[model samples]
Target: TGLTPWLAWVRGQAPPRRDFNPCGAYRFVRHPVYLSFMGLVWFTPTMTLDQAVLTGVWTVYLFVGSWLKDRRLEHFIGEPYREYERRVPGYPLMLVGPLATKRT
Candidate 1:
């Protein structure tokens, strides 16, 4: 969600702190916006051939991009991001019940 990254940005702007924010929308998933995009693309009532191809390509991109982003976050935020990864489910799993838990 917008608020998640915005909070991170705000934190980064402050002095003597480089913290990981696993709050709000991020409590459920690492990439809530991408999950939302997947839902919008896949849950359409009808899909043309072009739409289907686009959906397939975009889905692949989302997963691959998320993986790369995970690497980047781990490198940038280090242990905290890794610990957050251990706690939160990614993507589709986040949509399911009981998988999401709030962690400080």
Candidate 2:
């Protein structure tokens, strides 16, 4: 986030707090905003060859961005983020796959 609390992490100091539970779409996926952007990039009705190439590049960029974000949050937010990762998928389709939450 590059905010003051995030800056504290860079300085090797504790953040003001570690509470960062996002609501709404976050409940379904760890990176809902990334998923939304991907939808915009991929769901065009007509895809020309150039558009297809652009979409492919953008897809990789978004996927890498989402993964880097997870690593950053894990580094900064620590255990809670790991727990959240366990409970939430990185993307909605993962809800039914290997990283899906285990029932208890």
Give me the runs in candidate 1 sitting further than 4 Å from their true place.
Answer: 1-16, 94-104
Q: Taking the tens digit of each residue's C-alpha lDDT, what string does model 1 give over 18-53?
A: 467777888877889889999999999999999999
lDDT of 2 by residue, 1-104 (tens): 35987789889998677497879989878887888889998999999999999999998888788778888888988888888888888887665543344333
Off by more than 4 A, model 2 = 1-15, 95-104
Q: How far is candidate 1 from the true structure (C-alpha RMSD, Å)?
A: 7.0
CA error at residue 69 for candidate 1, angstroms: 0.4
Root-mean-square deviation of Cα positions for candidate 2 versus the true structure, in angstroms? 3.6
| Candidate 2: pairs in clash | none
How far residue 61's Cα lies from its native spot in candidate 1, in Å, is 0.4
